[model samples]
Target chain A: MKRHQNLLMALAVVVLVALPLWMVHKPAPGPDGKEAEIFAGADSQAEGLIGRIDPGYRPWVKPLMEPPSGEIETLLFALQAALGAGFIGYWYGSASTRARLQREQETTTSC
Target chain B: MHIMEGFLPAKHCIAWGIASAPFVAYGLRTVTKRVREYPEQRMLIGVAAAFTFVLSALKMPSVTGSCSHPTGTGLGAILFGPAAMAPIGAVVLLFQAILLAHGGLTTLGANIFSMAIVGPFAAAAIYRLVRAARLPFGVAVFLAATLGDLLTYVTTSVQLALAFPDPVGGFWASFTKFATVFAVTQVPLAISEGFLTVIVCNALARLNPRELQEMRVATGSEQEVQA
Candidate 1:
């Protein structure tokens, strides 16, 4: 039963990922053949809408640091996440190990 | 939804910030109380925040030939409840805005309101309701995570609609347009997130029943054995 569930989940993931990729990459009927970017991050899409709504509107704020390139931006984001995950994983592992050891020592002393 | 830098009018941004302030305060209080009661939970909260950060950073292809990321609040909401997740989510959003340039400081309040407060609360509510219904753990997790993700997008759509109502059809029409666009990407992402959370939850339950128990996830039989 467990194996069946896992297989189903794996299949679901493949389909979910593949369907989108295929849709995105498929040739479009437009003259340009380039598909329009229908899905934008909420921020950009919202900004675009705001621009359309009121052309004279100026942005009140700016990003603190913009990465030199998109790749660099992605790299920095990934780095931060990795560092955070590493710290968290280490902390959890050590705490759990210490707790187990303390429990074992208590049982031995009691015996 | 991350309202871009200068996307929302100044008033909208300030309003969202004010709206989220109380929730953030409450969440900090919850975290402090938990940490005081159990020093180990300090690390757990940090781990939860990191987990949210890492998972949300994963970009996936969407139906519209664009990339979207998961919100990743479901697992944390399941572990720590919604109130506790608010502060953790705030940290993640702040990092994304500053480091990734994904969101802006001015829009941070709106982003936090949608992704942090609303998303986690929705996830927690759904998880609790489904679990109370005595459904399978996997099903509950899947529903909570998927719906939580969808709800984030929905909230974002509403925010956008409110800010820029369509000239022709007004707020409702504008909202529909935004929601439709978001749905194309978000629906698949939500399903993927649901499966991922369930897999992660199951793995945690098997490998670290103690952690699951500490987080108060009902590991059922496995937890019983460990106890």
Candidate 2:
């Protein structure tokens, strides 16, 4: 189970990193939708099934309401993602800092 | 705060995913180190995992009657401390979004930024201030927990506003509704967080005072100087 979890997490990381790169670097649409066009059908169909089956699917709609466009929207999305990752990094860093400080206090006080 | 799909543009979610990656990396390191250090690391993992699972399940209705659950930052902060809580939170949020589909994959960054990042810092800062001011831990914990909850909503409101067709009014209207509606349920939860923080901290402070002391030292937070 742990191995599977670790693998899944690794996959999430790859997709996250690769997607942004692909979006930015991928040739500006030669035809219908980007590579996402292929997967989007499966994705939406899944959403459709869930919404149809689950009475409590209303909350999931808000984040998927609109597709982004142009440079500005893309920039905003990137900024938001960067901020999210940074915030998480900062959080754990701060926690460790606190723990270290606690350990130091114990040392100084006892001495 | 749940970041629903369609709340932001799809591009935004993609960006959020990118932004959240480094944090996950840092979190992975933290998880490894901590797991290695503690003798009962496996147990610790189990406990954190279980509580997070249960907390996510305990959804309540808002004025929108859209259901929301506790951030559980207070709970994480109590057991793991705020720094440690970050990774735990990131992992939990990711799991919730991906596995449960409770939150959107695209909005993972904003959702995590709101819940994991904001929540514990709110508690930690307040607690430290209380120590500096020589107020009881009890008071500090309460204020921290309350503000933590408040901050989560405020952040959520901003994200929702930014995503809509009409950003400003959309944000204000949603903010007003959620901020108001969540308070009733959130109040008790905040208090519970505070109460739990103090209780748990007290237990830690008593048991193996040296290790707890080492924690503070390693973290570089000053001892509570009675003012």
Among all candidates shown, the one with the greatest DockQ: 1
Q: Per-residue alpha-carbon lDDT of model 1 for A80-111, expressed as tens digits?
A: 76876687578658766876787799899999
Q: Model 2, B82-104: lDDT tens per residue?
A: 66666767777765555444466
CA displacement after TM-score superposition, residue A111 of candidate 1 (Å): 14
Model 2 Cα lDDT, one tens digit per residue, A1-111: 434533554454345333433443323565675552221211233234334334353543543323334454435434434544454345346555766888799899999
Q: Tell me the spans in candidate 2 whose CA falls farther than 4 Å from its real position.
A: A1-111, B36-50, B60-67, B78-81, B165-174, B181-185, B206-208, B217-227
Model 1 lDDT tens row, B1-227: 67777777888999999999899999999889888887756655776677687767877777766667788888888888899888888888898888877778888888899889888999999999998999988999999999998999899899988988888899998888788767556888899889977876765565556666777789565645456
Fnat of every candidate, listed in order: 0.58, 0.06
The global C-alpha lDDT for each of the candidates, from Candidate 1 onward, is: 0.79, 0.52
